[model samples]
Target: MLPLLVVSALAAVQSLAYEQTLGFNSAPIVETRSLDEIYHAALAEGGVVTFWLGGDEKGDEDAIKKEFEGKFPGMTLNLTTDLSKYHNGRFDEQLAAGHVYVDSIAFQTVHDFPRWEEQGALLHYAPVGFDKIYPPMRDVRAAYYGILTVGWAGKWNTDKLPGIAAPIEWEDWLRPEFKDKLVLTYPNDDDAVLYAFDLIMQQYGKSWFERLLKQNPRWVRGTRTPDTVMQASNSSWAASFTSDGLFPTSNINVSHPVQGSFVTWFQLAAIPKDAPHPEGAKLLHNFMLTKEWQATRGSWPVRSDVEPPTGYPAIFEMPGTNITYFREWMSDRAKLERLRTWFEDKLGSAQGLSPLIDGI
Candidate 1:
C-alpha cells in the first residue's frame, strides 16, 4: 500500500486535473479573441449554430435569428423557443439518443444547468464579457452565466385605483381598502411567484398571507393574465406581474417592492459539450454579451458596464432585491412539492396555465 501522504497528494492532483479540464476558472477555455476572429473561425467550421431558448413565442426566436444574421453576415442562426420544462425534456431525449442537436441553450431551468455541468454535457466557454459579468450571476465553475435578470413586482392600474397611492412594499398590498380589487397569480403556478411568496412569508409571517386571502382577491393562472387584467381595468392591482418596463402609455404601472423583490430567475446560457458547431456557439455567445445586443434585448444585462434601460436600476442597485441562489429549493423535490401542496390548500387549486412561456 502507498503511504497515506502520497495517496492524499495523488487524490488532490486528480481533483485539480478534473477541474482544470472543465475550465472552472473564469478564464474561458476558448482563447481570448475578438468577435471578428471568432466569427471567421466559425465560418471555417460550417457557420451554423442552433439555440433552444425558454419561451413559447416565435417572435423572440425570429428576432434573435434576424439580428444575429444581420450582425454577422453569411452565418445562420436557428433558434427554437419553448417552455424551459419542454426544452429540458428535449435535451434529455437528445442526450439519451446520443445525438445532441443544439449548439447552445438559454433557459429559466437554472437548477438543471448544474446537473448538466456535472454530467459533462455543458461546455465551459466564457464569452468575451464573462469577466465583466456580476460575480453572483456567473457560475463559480464557469460552466454557465446568467445572461439576463427578470423581475416580478407589484403592478397597479392608475385608472382603476384613481386617487389611492400605489403600494411601495409587499405589506402595503395587505391594506384593507385594496382588498377584493387585487388579482394574484397562484403562488404554486410559477417558481418566480413561488419565490416571491416565500420571501413574503419569510418577511411578514404566514398570518399575512392568511389575512390577504380573507380579502377574497381574484387568483389567476399565468403571469400575463394579471397584467392583462390590470391593463383592461378589470383589476385595480396585481401582486405578481412581470415588469417589462414597456407599458409607458398604458395605465398599468409597476412598483418595485421596497422590502426587496425576488428575482424570478436569471436566464442562464451555456454551450453544450457535444455541440456540432462550437466555434459558432462561441461566436454567438460573445456577440450576445456585447453592449449593443444586451441593451436591445430589454432584460437586465449581467455585464457591469451595460446600463439598464431608462427608469430601471441595475440588479445590484435594486433595494431589498433577494437574488439568493435557489439551487437548494430546486434540488429538494419533496420539500418543493410539499410547499406547493401547502399553498394550494390555502390559496386553492392553480388554474392549469401552460408552462410553454417563461415556465411561470
Candidate 2:
C-alpha cells in the first residue's frame, strides 16, 4: 500500500509538470489605465510585486519607475533593491520553501534560469507582444525575457594598452606583458564572465591558462568591479569581459579582438510561478519591455522598433556569437566548489598564471 501511494504521488507531480511546461504559453500585451486609477488600484492591490535590481541596473530604477507610472496606471511595482549577499543561495531556499519575496527578478543567467527552472520557480507566462521577442530572448517555460540588452567584448583603455589595436586578437589571457595586468571577474559569480571564458577557450584553445598567467590580474567580486577599476585607471586592464553598450568614459572603446566574433549576452527579467498577483505582474512585465521605457533608460532595448538613445553603440554592429549552455564550463554543482577552492588556493596568487593552453 505504501509503495502504491508513493507511485501515485510521483505520477501526480509529473502530471503538473507537463501541464505547466506544455501549457498555453503566449505573450499577451498588457492593458493600460489612467494614472489616478493605476496608483489607487496598486495601492489596494491584493498581493505584493517585488523586483531585483543588480548593481549595474541600480542606475536605471528612476526611468523604470517613471515608465511604469506612465504606462500601467494602476499597477504597483513596489520598486526595491536587494543586494542580499546570498542571491543564488537564498533563491534556492525561497524557491524550495515556496516563499516568493521576489515576484519578479532582473538578473544575470549564470544560474538564475536553469537553477530556478529546475526548482519550478519560473512561472510559464507569455506577456502580450511576446511574438516580438527574439528566439533567444524568450524562455518557453520561464515566463521572462531579457529586456536590458548588451553585447560582450574585450574593452580596454587605449591610452594604457598603447600600440594595441582597437580589439586585439586575443585567444587567451596569459601574454607575458599582460600577465598580472589582466582585469577579470570570476564567471562562477557572473555567468557572462563564465560565458566569455568558455567562448574564448572554445574558439581558441582549452589550455588557455598560459594567457591568464602573463596578464597577472586582480580579482573583483563582481564583473562591474573589474570594469570600474579599468575605468578609474587603478590598473591597466589589457582585456576583460564587459558590456560594450556602457563605458566608464569616451576614453574606453569596445573592440572585437577577433574581427568577426563578438559574443553578446543578455540580462533577463522574469515573473515567478504561483505569483499572488499574476495579472499585475503581467502588466508590469509588458510595461517594462516597451520601447519608451527602454529608450528613456539610455540602455539598449531588445525591440527592433526602438532606436538606441543618442551616443549609444549599436549592439548588432559588432559580430554576435550566441552563448550556448556549457555544463563543464559552468563547473556544474560540484565543479563550482572545486573552482572556489582552486581560486582561493592556487589561482589566487598574484604571480602571473601560466596559460594552460595544451591538454586542457
In order, what lDDT does every prediction score? 0.72, 0.55
lDDT by residue (206-236, candidate 2, tens digit) is 4664456545666555544555667666556
Model 1, span 1-360: residue lDDT tens: 999866765654343324334444444484489999999999999989998898634453578888899999989998888767678999876665556789999987788887777666777777888888888778865789987666666677777666677777777877776777787777786665676677778888999888888878887765566666666534455333443343344566666766645544568899987899999999888988888888876567778899876777776676767454564466666777788888988777876546344343
State residue 232's C-alpha deviation in candidate 1, in Å: 3.1
Q: Pairing residues by index, what is the TM-score of model 1?
A: 0.81
Candidate 1, residue 159: how far the Cα is off, in Å: 2.2
Best by TM-score: 1
Give the CA lDDT, 0 to 100, for residue 355 in model 1: 34
Angstrom error at residue 117, model 2: 5.7
Model 1 — which ten-residue stretch has the worst lDDT? 238-247
Q: Which pairs clash in model 1?
A: 260-320
Going through the candidates in the order shown, the clash numbers are 1, 31
- Model 1, residue 31: what's the lDDT? 48
What is the C-alpha RMSD, rounded to one decimal, of candidate 2? 7.5
